[model samples]
Target: MNAFLQEVLTPGSIVQLATLASLIASVNFGVVGTYVVARRITYIAAAIAHSVLAGIGFAVFARAHFGWDWCAPVLGAIVAAVISAIIIGYVSLYLREREDTIISVVWAVGMSAGLLFLYYSPGFNGNLESFLVGSILYIAPADLWIMGALGLVVVLLCLFFYNPLMAVCFDEEFARLRGVNVPLYYMLLLILTSLSVVLLVQLAGIVLAIALIVLPAAAGLHATGKLWHAMCLATVLAMIQSTLGIAWSYTVEIPAGPAIILLSAASYLAVFGWKWWQSLRAASSLPIRS
Candidate 1:
C-alpha cells in the first residue's frame, strides 16, 4: 500500500492521473447518481452518454478537416450532452407518449453519426480505443483540471438545491404542489445527468459510463434509506472502488477502465448480498405465524 501510494502520488504520473479521474468521477457520480436512482432515469443518462459520442466525433472532424485548434472533443461532448438532455427532457415532459421512442432513436443515431463523422474526417489517424473504452493512463493535466471544475459545479448545485431536487425525485406531484417548478427541476436533473455522463465517460469510457453512475448509487440505496445518507455513502463507495480497481489493475497489468467498472459491480453485489443476509436474519428472528 505504501509503495502504491508513493507511485500514484508522483506529480503528472499516470497513477496521479488515474487518481484525479477517479476522484472527479466519485463526485459526479455520487451527487448526480443519487438523483438518477431516485428518479429512475438511468436510461436517460445512458442515452446522453452515448449521444456525447456525436459531439466528440464532430469535434474531431472539425479539428482534422478545418484545422481548428480550439476544437476540444470534451467541449463538443458537453454541448452535445446538453442538447441531448434538452431534447429528451422536452419530449418526456410534453410528449410523454414518445419518450421511450425518442430516447431509443437518440441513443442509436448519435453513435452512428459519431462513427460516420470519424470515418470521413480527413488527416485524422488517432485510435478510438481510448474514447470508446477510456484510457485513464493517458489523462492529461488539462483533462483533470476540467473535470475538477465540473465536479465542483455538480457538488455546489446539489448542495444549493438539495431540498427541491429531493422533492422532485421522490414525489414530483408533491414538489409541484409545494410550488417548485416541476418542469424546470426535471430539466435541471437531466442536464445534471448529462454532465455526470460526460464525466463518467472520461473515467470509464462511453461503453461503461452508466455502470459508474448506477452501481455505486445502487449500493448506497441498498445500504441506506435516507437520500442524503445514500448520496454520501455512494460517493465514498465509488472512491473506494475506483482506487481499488486502479490498484488491482496495476498489479495485474489490465486496463484501468474495465477494472474500475468490474470492481464497482463487485462492490454492488457485495452490498446486495449483505443486505439480503440482514433481511434473512431479521426474518429468522421473527416468530412463526403458523
Candidate 2:
C-alpha cells in the first residue's frame, strides 16, 4: 500500500494515468450502465464488447497491410462497437423472435473474426494480452484524451435525452404511447452503451468489460429507486472501485482489471445481501394475520 502511494505521489508516473483513466471511465460506467441495467440489456452490451475485437483486429491488419497508420486500434474499437450496437439494436427492436440467437451469433462470430485477423496480421502483436484482458496502467496520454472526450460526449447526450431515455428504459410501451419514438431512443441507448463498453474495454478488457459496466450500476440500483440517483451513486461506486482496484493490483502484483472487477462484484454482493437481510427482517416484523 505504501509503495503504491509512493508511486502515485511520484512526479508524472503512469499510476497517475491509470488512476485518471479509471475516474474518467467511471462516469460512462455509471451513466450508460444505469440505462443498460434498467433496460436489462447487459447481454447486448456484452455482445458489443466482444464484437469490438473485430474492429481492433481489422485495424491492426489494415495498418500492417494497407499502411493506414491513422487507423489506431482504439479507433477501430469505436467503429466496431457502434456498428455492433446498431445491428443488435435492430434485432432487438424488429427481429424480436431470433434476437437471442442472432446476438449469440454476433458474439461468437466477432470473436472468431478477431482472432483470425490477429493471426494473419503478420506482426508480433505484443499488446494482444492487454487488449484481451486489459492493461490500464500502461495507457498512453493520447488514450486518456480520447477516453475523456468520449466520456464527455456520452454524459452530454444522456443529459439531453434524460426524460425520453428514462421513459424508454422503464416502460417502452408507455413511452411509445406518449409519442416518444421508442425505437430511436432505444437505439440511442444501445449506442451510448457501446461507447461505454469501449471505455470499459480499455480498463478491464473485453472479457471483463461487462462486469465493470453492470456491477456498479447494479449496486447503485439496489441502493436507490430513482434513475438519476442510481446514476450518481453508481458513478461514485465505480470511481471508488476503480481506485481501490488499482491500488490492490499494485500491492498484490496482479492485473488491475480483474482486481477492480473483484472489488465491484464484492460490493454488489454485499449490497444485495444487505438488502435481502433487510427484506427478511421486514417480513419477520410484519403483524400476524389470521
Candidate 3:
C-alpha cells in the first residue's frame, strides 16, 4: 500500500495524473453538482454526458479523414455537450412537454452516432475505450491542463453568481420575479453542467461519468442544509473516493473509473442506510400523534 501511494503520489506518474484529474473533476462536480441536485436536473447531466460521445466519435473521424489538427476528441466533446445542453435546456425550461422523451432520444442518438463514427475512424480505435469507460490512469498532460482551466472557470462562475444560481435552483418563478434572468441563468447552468460532464469524460467516461458528478453531491446534500456546505462536503467525498479508487485499482489491477464509481456507490449506500436508520429512530422517539 505504501509503495502504491508513493508511485501514485510521485511528481509525474499515471497515478499522479489520476489524482490530479480527480481533484479537477471534484471542483467542477462540487459546484455544478450542487445546482444539479438543487434544481433536480440530474437527468440533464446524464444527457449531456451520454451525448458527448457523438462529439468524441466525430472528432476522431474528422482527425482521421480531414486531418483537422484542432479537432481533438475532447474539443469535440465540449462542443457536443454544450449543444446538447442547449437543446435539452430549451426543452425542459420551455417546451416542458415530453421533455423526458426528447432527452431519451438525444441520449440514444448521440451514443449510436458516436459508435458509428468510431467504427470508421482510421486504425486502432482502442483509444475510444477510454472515452467509453474512462482511462484516468492514462490521462495525458494536455487533458490535465484542460481540466485545470475548466475547473477554474467553474469555481469563478459559481463564486460570482452564487445567489442568482441558488435562486434559480430553488424557485425559478420566484427568481424571475426578483429579476434574476431565469431563462438566461438556466441556460448558463446547463452549459456549466455540460462542461463538468466533459471534464469527467476522461475520468469516468461517457457511460459512468454521471456517477462522479451526481453521487457525491447527493450524499453531501443529504447531510448538509446549505448549498455551499453541501458542495464542500461533496468535493471532499469525491476526493476520498477518487484517491481510494486509484489506490485500489493499483492493488487489484482494475480500471480506475469502475473502481472509483464502486467506492462511491458503497459510500452512498452507507449514507443512505444511516439516514434511513436515523429517520426510523426519530419516528420511534416522537410522541405518538393519536
Candidate 4:
C-alpha cells in the first residue's frame, strides 16, 4: 500500500495513469449510463460491449496478417460498437417482436466471431487478457488521450440532445407527436451507449463492463427522481468506486477491474437496501387509513 502510494505520487507512473483513466472514464459511464438505465436498454449496451471484441479481434488479425498498421484495437472497437448499436437499434425500432432473439444473436455472434479471429491470428496475442479482464495499471498515455476525447464527445452530445433524449426515454410516442424525430434520437441514444460501453470495456473489460455502467446509475436512480441528479450522483459514485477499488487492489494484490466492480455492486446493494428500508418505514408511518 505504501509502495503503491509512492508510485501514485510519482509523476506519470502507471498508478497515476490508472487513476486518471478511471476518473476520465467515469464521466461517460455516468452520463450515457443514465440514458441506458432510463430507457431500459442495458441488455443492448451489454451486447454492444461484447460485440466490441469482434472488432478488436479483426483489428488484431489485420495488423498481424495483412500488415494494416492503422487498424488499432480501439478503432476496431469503435467501429464494431457503432455497427452493433445501429443493428440493435433498428431491430428494437422496427422488429420489436424479435428484440430478445436479435439481441441474443448479436451477443453470441460477436463473442464467437472475436474468438475465431483471435484463434486464426498468428501470435500469442498477449493483450487479449487485458482486453478480457482489463489492466488499467498497464495503460499508456495514448489510451488516456483517446479516452478523454471520447468522453468529451459523449458528454457534449448528451447535453445538446438532453431534451429530445429525455422525451425519447420517457415517452417516445409523445416525442414523435411533438415533431422530435423519435427514431433518430433513439438511434443516437444507442450510439452514445456504444461509445460509453467501449470506454467501460477499456477500464473493466467486457465481462465486468455492464456492471460498472449499470450499478452506479441504478443506485443514483434509487436515490433521486430527476435525470440530471441521477447522472451527477452516478458519476461521483463511479469515481469514488474506481479510486477505492484501485487502492484496495493495490493493498491486497487483487485484480483492479474485479475489485472495482465488486465495490460498485456492494455500494449499489447498500444504497438499494437503505432505500427499501426507508420506503418500508414510510409505509409503516402512514396513519391508519380506511
lDDT of 3 by residue, 117-235 (tens): 98888744467678889988878888899899988997899879999999888888999998789989989999999999999887989989998888888888888889999999888
Off by over 4 Å in 4: 288-290
**RMSD, candidate 3, Å:** 1.8
Better of 2 and 3 by lDDT: 2
TM-scores for every candidate against the unseen true structure:
0.96, 0.96, 0.95, 0.96
The Cα local distance difference test for each model comes to 0.89, 0.92, 0.88, 0.91
Return the clash pairs for model 2, or none: none
Give me the displacement of residue 66 in model 4, in angstroms: 1.1
Model 3 stretches with alpha carbons more than 4 Å out: 281-290
What lDDT tens digits, residue by residue, belong to model 4 across residues 146-238? 999999999999989999999999999999999999999999999999998998898989888998999999988889999999999999999
Best by lDDT: 2
Clash totals in order: 0, 0, 0, 0
- Compared with the true structure, what per-residue lDDT tens digits does model 1 show for residues 84-156? 9999999999999999999999999989988888888876676788888887877789999899998888789
- Candidate 2 CA-lDDT value: 0.92
Cα displacement (angstroms), candidate 3, residue 25, comes to: 0.8
